[model samples]
Target: MNLHADAVTVLSAWAPSLGSQESLRQAFLGFLATRDDTVQRSCEAGHLTASAVVLDSTGTQVLLTLHPRVGRWLQLGGHCEPSDASVADAALREATEESGMTGLEIGAAPVHLDVHPITCSLGVPTRHFDVRYAVRAPAGALPVRSDESDDLRWFPVDALPAGSEDLAELVNAAVSSH
Candidate 1:
């Protein structure tokens, strides 16, 4: 199935970790039911984005990218692309592209769901309904920073950036799910 259909299937079957997430999941499914283009960036109303919290082989370190545009550390992910076959593929693709790491394995189900507003590449205010997964980097895999990142580094699960609550929560969800 296509990414749009796969998103519906995946989220429909997913179990939310928090009470708040269930409403967001319902919203996502509702959006998908109305628009075929919800998976693409062109849908200005808001779109689905896939991201992953990159956990090290040992699950002690989390890889984060200091997004040049947002000027903060975030999970490895981005807008879903036409080439993406599924949400999981998009998450893994973004993780590999931004982290420059290979042999990454993504969990079969999402670890969390989040929606936030931003002026992304579209250059207009938009909302990103993010589907987040937990990904495992290969043992001894070293990361190289991409042009998309101001910095790409791993932080101990307990030592995430001082003010990043979202990152901390994503890490917590990913670690707990693992």
Candidate 2:
């Protein structure tokens, strides 16, 4: 299937809140409009990326990246490329790449979605419309930090690290979504 068709299929399957193709198309277009320059370029160039939050079987634990630049623990995700046929694929790909965990299994549906402004090392503004998904890793699978993260650790859902209220809310929502 083609990119647009694949996107339609995935969205139709997952986002039942969207009632029709026209609504889904509008939603997608609305998502596109919210992107910053970097993300806009990526989408225009057809290189949109995604990410996911991986949890253990009990759902009490979550894997987080200590972002090098942001200096905070966050879910694994990144830019979408041409190879990623669907948003879910992009999210799962980023999670695996960043966490270095094998046998990653992403849920068929998104747990939540959020858009936030990000400025890269060069101070270029970008908007990330993160399609956060619930994912599971094999038991005993250890996470190795990639260059994107200074450290990788599992945090208990009840005891999130110190951060902005917004982040706390996002984390809570993700946890509850599972």
Query: In angstroms, how far off is 19's CA in candidate 2?
Result: 15
Runs in model 1 with CA error above 4 Å?
Answer: none
* lDDT tens digits by residue: candidate 2, 28-132: 555544543323234432223466878876777788888888888788887766677677887888989998988988887666556556764334676555566
Residue 110, candidate 2: C-alpha displacement in angstroms: 1.0
Best-matching candidate per lDDT: 1
Estimate the overall C-alpha local distance difference test score of candidate 1. Answer: 0.93
Candidate 1 residues 76-175, lDDT tens each? 9999999999999999999999999999999999998989999998999999999999999999999999999999999999998866766777798999
Q: Pick the candidate with the highest TM-score.
A: 1
Q: What is the C-alpha lDDT of each candidate?
A: 0.93, 0.67
For each candidate in turn, the TM-score is 0.97, 0.76
